[model samples]
Target: MGAMVYWVILSLSILALGVWVFWSVRGVRAYVRARGKRLVTCPETHCAAAVELDAKGASWKAFRGGNYFRLQDCSRWPERQDCAQDCLQEIETLGQGCLVRTIVAGWYSGKTCVYCRKPLDKVEEWTGHMPALLDPDQKTVMWGEVPPEKLPGVFENYKPVCWSCHIAETFRRVHPELVTDRPPRW
Candidate 1:
């Protein structure tokens, strides 16, 4: 009877450990997925705004099977931040679709460089191999050069340029005397 009771206690302890592991992993996944700069239209002002989620709070809530979220930062702050965060509803519904990375990736898809005519591939956000945007005045600028708040406007007005062209154009623009414009050999 003593041996049987000991085995039962050990089994219950293992089961409790398993449950804790499951819940912790679930919470971590929720944190990673929610941590990012999200673009959402402010329901109050009906305009585009950059917002970040309170990922730490969301993760903690996830452990209890709840998915609560609130604003950690916003572009419309200091003036209208105290207003109700109706934008979170958009984020909850859109999920990854509202992420800035997703929006930029969609813009770059199927696009060719305005300068060299090279087809743009995936924008490597992590690999440091990103394309650039050509402004209306023929200025070349990388995505990082644009602020998060201005991304929506930049996407609407700027044209995509492959990395190679961006580098060449930037060099030429900076040092015109060093670069001789040559007609295409073809």
Candidate 2:
């Protein structure tokens, strides 16, 4: 009788542990899905608008991945929803890096291009972001590689780059030998 009682206690303990673990995992999953929104701007000539995207949704992944680079049905340019790249592109899940940068953009300057120092005519000019290089000698800035823990300290480091300069800077950083003369603004 004592042996049976011991066995039953052990079984109950195991069941309780399993239940605790299951609830913990489900709670964490729910918490993770509860938050996140990506602010996207639609650049369509006919329908320019800004919409906040749900980060948990697939659409947000494509939108925030490259701000419409791969996914087209994002707030930035929803009209491109039918593009092959939209669904095929990998989703960039938002975290501290994305949040801090957007916050910095609001606190700092959003009206002009940091590279070219030109007024960003929203209707005509498209804009992008390139993370600020912490080490001048590093040769290039890879936003994805920027550690999230360091973002809080370098809110001012995020630079607003117009599409034209973003293209040039990205190319120059990636292939330094290809670009000999710098843009006049650079």
Candidate 3:
């Protein structure tokens, strides 16, 4: 009789754990849906729009995956503020790394360092490594090992810079004049 009781208790505990996990996952999905910003398409007009979600708002819905969230009435959301369409179009046209490449190119292309106004050099000189920096998630080297045909958008224009320049520029963006006093050293 005691063995049966223990088995029943174990089964109930497992059931309770499963229910708790389900509820927790549901809550996370709801949160992601509310916080995530996504480009959504309108089915009626076949128009695309950027939808900003207020995670705390009443109309937010849980995305299929607990990793993200979406708006329940995306169309009803104001059109003027709906940048999702433009965002989506750009994403489709340029792919994920487009913006990053553009930014890096702009910085390298004679845009003086925020601190010293010195021209940034190509990455090969500073690091002695072919690729300067890599995309953390994609594991692709942004500077080296990129083929011309595979270059997305402006990434082909990417140039490598010495570590000193990169570090100084990063610091200047956050705290202007912080790294200016330091001499540029490779």
Candidate 4:
């Protein structure tokens, strides 16, 4: 009788261990499959930040906010009045995933214009690369076109500018002399 009792106890323990192992493997696989680039709002509506996360739970699509301003506060950028970039960081999501698919082009997926506070759909989105220097000399911006090798890597040192602003700025940088002296026809 004692021997039989010991065997039963051992079998129960082995079964429990097996169950735990299976669940662990399942969870790890889920994490790997779901791991990738993602975008999300802070949920509070207006604030700074672009949070990325690794999660283990049912996937979800982003909420359809009426406008980019609702998704993120653009007021962070006051000098240019253009919301060029949203502060970015990564976090491991717990039990749920917090993410929205980005258009993969601009800092914020070409959603808002980096110049005017306008909807991206109405204006053409331009991927503007930052020259090697933060404030490139007038000559570089106007006359010199830095080769691809010298340009910053994708998603680095870039902003989404509207067509009008892009054309205006491009000329300002590439041919500063052409437009500087001419006064705006107000």
Candidate 5:
């Protein structure tokens, strides 16, 4: 009888542990997916703002069955932060669409590098090779170098460059004396 009681208790414990683990994993996924630079229109100012969500806070709240989203950082901070976070509604509605990663990836899709004319693939952090953009004046720059609030305009005005060409162009621009012009061998 005692052995049967022990077995039942062990089964219950294992079941409880499994339930806990399931919730924890779901919460963590919610947190990770929500983490990223997001673009939203500020309700009060009616201007675009770059914002980061409070991922940790949302993760903790996820355990309670709903995510509690709040702004972790914003481009229009220190001056207009006190305003109600009506912008979160946009995130709640759009989900991953507002992420800068998603937006940039969409922009690069089906496009070739302006420099090498090679197809620009998805941005891969593991490969340590991120693509760049060529500004209107022909200067090469990374996306992070531009302010998030100005990304919309920049995206419209700039041209995409592959990782290899970006490095080559930057090197040539920085050391023009060392980089001699080569005639087309073709």
Candidate 6:
């Protein structure tokens, strides 16, 4: 009876271990399949490589010789946008001077604050402060302090502006139809 009980316990433990191993392997395989680059043949010269689509679906990168090359959806070489275009254009223009080629080519590297026209690098300078409009309406304003979480995007696109400028710019961008007249205060 003792021998039978010991054998049963050992068998159950082995079965549980086997199940755990199977589940773990399956999860890893699924993740790899979802994230792995798909193999493709270059249409230009029939060269084989691995390619992955970016979030925009318009851009793609092909991995070849341990390096990644940016290629558009049409499989052509990437080109810079117009010089007058905002943060993205400035970044592209400065690309010649930047030593980090990989980051320069990546997305969001060149976007700047809309108001100050400063590069995204200075985002930390103007976060967690009250906007000028809030100062006047402090008593009525429900939120006593600006939440830290909302600072990143706001600072990224509209830093260095006094509170009034920030509000004006934000309103202009988010509600162009409603704000026909520019705020005379700024």
Clashing pairs in 6: 132-163
Candidate 5 per-residue lDDT, tens place, 64-118, comes to: 5886879989999878778788999998998899998788888888888997898
Q: After superposition, how far is residue 159 of candidate 4 from its true place, in Å?
A: 15
Q: Model 2, range 1-186, lDDT digits (tens) per residue?
A: 999999999999999999877655654553344333333222333232222323345334332332222322343345555534321211244333234345434444445656777654443221344433323443335445654434444454454445566567778878988879856684
RMSD of each: 2.6, 16.8, 12.0, 15.4, 2.1, 15.0
Query: Which stretches in model 3 have alpha-carbon errors above 4 Å?
Result: 23-51, 54-186
Instruction: For each candidate, give its TM-score against the true structure.
Output: 0.83, 0.33, 0.29, 0.28, 0.89, 0.24
- In candidate 3, what are the lDDT values of residues 1-186, reduced to their tens digit? 999999999999999999877766776655543443334444445554334444544222332323332243343455544534334444445433333333444446553433344555453443452223323332223343443223333344433444455554446657875545657689
Best-matching candidate per TM-score: 5
Q: Pick by lDDT: which candidate is best? A: 5
Give the runs in model 4 whose Cα sits over 4 Å from its true position.
39-51, 54-186
The lDDT ranking, best first, is 5, 1, 2, 3, 4, 6
Residue 170 miss distance in model 2 (angstroms) = 2.9
TM-score of 6: 0.24
Supply candidate 3's per-residue lDDT for 116. Answer: 43
lDDT of each: 0.86, 0.45, 0.45, 0.40, 0.87, 0.37
Which scores greater on lDDT, model 1 or model 6?
1
- The sequence of per-residue lDDT tens digits that candidate 6 reaches over residues 110-155 is 5543345545433243355332212232221212243322333333
